[model samples]
Target: MSQSFSLRTKSFLAGLVLPLLLGACESSVSVRGNFPDPEEVSSLEKGVHTRRDVADRLGSPSTLSTFQDQVWYYIGEKVEKTAFYDPVVLDRTVLIVKFSSDGMLEESHAYALEDGRVIDPVTRETPTEGQDLTIIQQLLGNLGKFNPGGNK
Candidate 1:
């Protein structure tokens, strides 16, 4: 009888612990973008590595400079998310590779999450030269526009 009770207790404990263990495994982590390895980054020799060499070594950059193409940006981000919660950024890397006018690598810079800054975007709306109509107004305006005769 004791042996049966012990088996039943172990089974009951395992049933409770299994769900908790599964629940704890809900966290999902994801890494996005082609982040270059440290060795690949180190292989770049300033002034010797041209645009082509850099591209061949590290792959195409995530993006180029906004206005000028002299600077290349390789961005990578790691995020973690769990059930019903907002994703949290676990890591972020922004590799800035600058080139001279002759297309030779001038310098390289790496920035991490701590180096980032938050900028509040401008919220003011740009007024356009058009009347804003309601849903009913839009529906009524479109009603007569289509010909019921199916004219081509």
Candidate 2:
């Protein structure tokens, strides 16, 4: 009702609302993102180099597959957040380098998220007969409980 009281209330509301609007604007302006180029990876010529040479050129790969020991893989993913809350996957890159039996670079390739997944995600559950069995249980199961010809 009083003019002074109304002015104080308006000042308080202004202080509160201004910061909120500023924060919203700041958040809207703030952003995070990344990009990777496949061309950053060097090429491997058939006769130019060996594994060591390739390593010397492109550092060590991120991973190696057990089934294909000769193959080396590099995979990376990036997640970006806006205003420190909304998370998004900005980009991803996969580089694969295959080696020959002699440990030389056999083949090399680079991939992007837009390229899509090479392997499809299988949702069908596999009937797993594999169960956790203790070593004692395994041994006892192997031994007959009541062997008629037992040399007990």
Candidate 3:
């Protein structure tokens, strides 16, 4: 009876432990945006492919140029994350397709992850020219400043 009980206990612990181990080892992959195929992009001929033809082959672009409607951009990113870590970018691709005023393709450009630049965000707060008042001062300062007529 004890032998059977011990074997059952081992089996139960193994079931729980195995799943936890597998779960811990699992990684997640996340893909965002439209990544155009190299072969299809290469097939396009500048000055030959029209807007309609490009759309049919590559689908809608991820975004259009901010100031001009002549350029279309396709941006793609792939990120991977382990069980508890922040996601890491595995791949990034940016494809830019420009069209002439007549709607024919003018130029095509591809940018890989290595071609990108990283800029650190500014964190320091700019000090404004003003008096720093305490809570009591702020409350007292507003006591006589109310204009019931809504004018200065």
Instruction: List TM-score per model, in order.
Output: 0.65, 0.52, 0.78
Q: Tell me how far the alpha carbon of residue 65 in candidate 1 is from the true structure, in angstroms, after superposition.
A: 2.5
Give candidate 1's whole-model lDDT: 0.94
Q: Which pairs of residues have clashing backbones in candidate 3?
A: none
- Per-residue accuracy of model 2 over 39-99 as CA lDDT, tens digit each: 4455568655787876666666777888867887777777654565775666677778788
C-alpha lDDT values of all predictions: 0.94, 0.70, 0.94
Tell me how far candidate 3 lies from the true structure as C-alpha RMSD in angstroms.
Answer: 4.2
Best by TM-score: 3
Question: In each prediction, how many residue pairs overlap at the backbone (N, C-alpha, C within less than 3 A)?
Answer: 0, 0, 0
Is candidate 2 or 3 superior in TM-score? Answer: 3
Question: Across residues 1-152, which tens digit of lDDT does each residue of candidate 3 receive?
Answer: 99999999999999999999998879989999999989999999998999999999999999998998799999999999998878899999999999999999999999999999999999999999989999999999999788878965
How well is each residue in 28-84 modelled by candidate 1, as lDDT tens digits? 999998689879999899999999999999999999999998999999999999987
Model 2 RMSD in angstroms? 10.2
Q: Could you tell me the lDDT of residue 60 within candidate 2?
A: 68
Model 3 lDDT, residue 127, Cα? 90
Q: In candidate 3, which residue ranges exceed 4 Å CA deviation?
A: 1-7, 129-152
